[model samples]
Target: MIGPQPVAVASAPLARRNPVAKLAAALLFSVVLIATLDPVAPAIAIAVELAVLPLFGVRYRVLARRAWPLLVSAVGIVVTLVLFAAERSGRVLVEAGPVAVTSGVLLTALGLVLRMIAVALPGVIVFATTDATDLADALIQNARAPARFAIGALAAFRLVPLLGQEWQAISMARRARGVDAGRNPVAKLRLFVSTAFALLVGAIRRGTRLAVAMDARGFDAGVPRTTARRQRFTAADALLVAGAVALGGAALTASILLGTFRPLIG
Candidate 1:
């Protein structure tokens, strides 16, 4: 007979810290960055975030890998803004038919790019460090989220990696059967769409099955559910929340004092 099982514990500080605390920190930082889209504010915030990432076990390379998509999108925005943003009375840098690049426009676009990076990177770091189960638990326990909804979200998060593996398996099977088209962009696009459709169908099937299983398990039986691991808010969590508030406030105050407080919409 199975007697007593030892409790599993997190060794790392990031892993041990409550997910609600991390979520609060990310939201606070994002709000500050979104309110003032000035380059100086984001620049300072970015520096602080960069230094803070190591506390969450995030390396520079890992951060870059996770944020490359945002970086690429930011670059695209810069290019589009430089080409099409309404020209203001400033020194014109480039004048080509229907496109005018000015110093003021470039600066504006740069500020947007910097702000995007500063706001998104912290969230990415938090997500990368936190486990999906821990996050769902924290949300349910600390944030007072509905248990059913939180569990459903946790199930969806679990399916993501499974879906990736399914896609890779399908691709490999196609290659084995010699139907995989390589090097042709049009064929690749079609293949990607077909794979995506397969994944969608699989996801729907899995979700339906999961819902039915939950119902069968009496999850909808109007009885309060008990958690396997009780989520607790520690002193560390309180400190994290306080630190988030202080950081966001400091960033905003510094931006205003430095005269770079440019509200995104005003």
Candidate 2:
């Protein structure tokens, strides 16, 4: 019975909003931020996101854990930009042989990293706080999405977590069969690749079976389907989407006022 579980906070107002609202808000917020290239707007957006975490019932520590990958990417961006960026217009901050780090390059990297995090964080929060089933239901009910598409997406998303467990199980089964990489890095890499391949094959087989089962259940019948659970798009949900737009607009406005608003197209 290992499956996707809802992470929505029962007592949190935002978390209890319709899943489509959360998703639309996240999308709108991200789309607005994508129009800017400066760090200032993203910085402000990040601040706004953090400030509203409690309202969403998402703790800072939980968000950090969920967002560690973005932090790692930020580090990679800084290193890559420092070593290879051509726009070294500002004063040199560090010079080591062929490696030069300029203020301009660093600022560009920071902006990119910040923008990435700011744009991505809302989606992360939405997914983290919302249930897959609820999202699918909301999409079908509130957003007027096709049932086939929403339900299919929900099925696919539910299968994602099983991949990790299956990988572990495959690795253990292999090890039990006297397959070990030992100390050699090359052998370890080969083992990893082989394991991944095996997992992929298993996943494909499982997916094929699941698709057949769904088809047999008349999922593609094109007939109207009835829902056991109804998802309502309330006034609060509308307010959530509006808040996202306002917050994003405020961030961009702050950047423009500060004269650091770099348009993405220009």
Candidate 3:
């Protein structure tokens, strides 16, 4: 049973909401924010998201851990824009040789980074708080998604944590066989690639076996499948989606009032 463990916060009000509702809320919030291309709106959206983390029983430390990748991406975006952006309309902040960092370029980069985090964080929160089984069940029951697709996706998701363990095991086995890369960077990269390839092959084999096992268990037998736990869409769930829409709209409205709202479509 070495699989992905669900976030242990059963008493969290928002975390206990229907999976379909959370999914819808995240999607709707992202969609509304996507209509604007300014830093202001996304900044507001991010503020709201952080403000509501406690309601979801997600601590600041947990969110920081989960969002480190986004922070890395933001740094990359800022650096790339500062170095290579062509639209340098505003005042120059820094100039060195062929590289010029202007306020316009910096603003655009900040907007992109903020928008990326704002748009992606909700999905991260949903997946972190919601169990795979509950998500699949909600998809099948509330969203009316195909059982085959939902169950298949759930099964695949449950195996994701194993990939990390499998990679480490493969690396250790290779090291035990005297396949250490030592101090050479090139050798390290080659070793990494070879280990990844081995992991991929093992994953494919495991997936095939899992598919066959599921088939044997009548998963795809075209008969009605009963759920062990039922997911219900409640009034609170509806309010959650509505609240997301309102929050996004308010952010955009603020941006518009501040004259920072840039439409995504020209």
How high is the CA lDDT of each candidate model?
0.80, 0.90, 0.91
- TM-score of every model? 0.83, 0.92, 0.93
- Residue pairs that clash (backbone atoms under 3 angstroms), model 3: none
The TM-score ranking, best first, is: 3, 2, 1
In terms of lDDT, the best-performing candidate is: 3
In angstroms, the error of model 1 at 5 is: 22
Which candidate, 1 or 3, would have the higher lDDT against the true structure? 3
Worst 10 residues of 1 by lDDT: 1-10
Q: What global local distance difference test value does model 3 have?
A: 0.91
| Separate clash counts for every candidate | 0, 0, 0
Which ranking of candidates, highest lDDT first?
3, 2, 1
lDDT by residue for model 2 (124-175), tens: 8999898888888889999999998998889989898899999999989989
Please report how far candidate 2 places residue 27 from its true position, in Å: 0.4
How well does candidate 3 match the true structure in TM-score terms?
A: 0.93
lDDT tens string, model 3, 1-266?
34465563778989999999999999999999999879999999999999998888888888788789999999999998888887898998888999888889988998999999999999888887898989999999999998999999999999998999999999999999999999999999999999999999999999999999998998888887888999999999999999999999999999999999999999
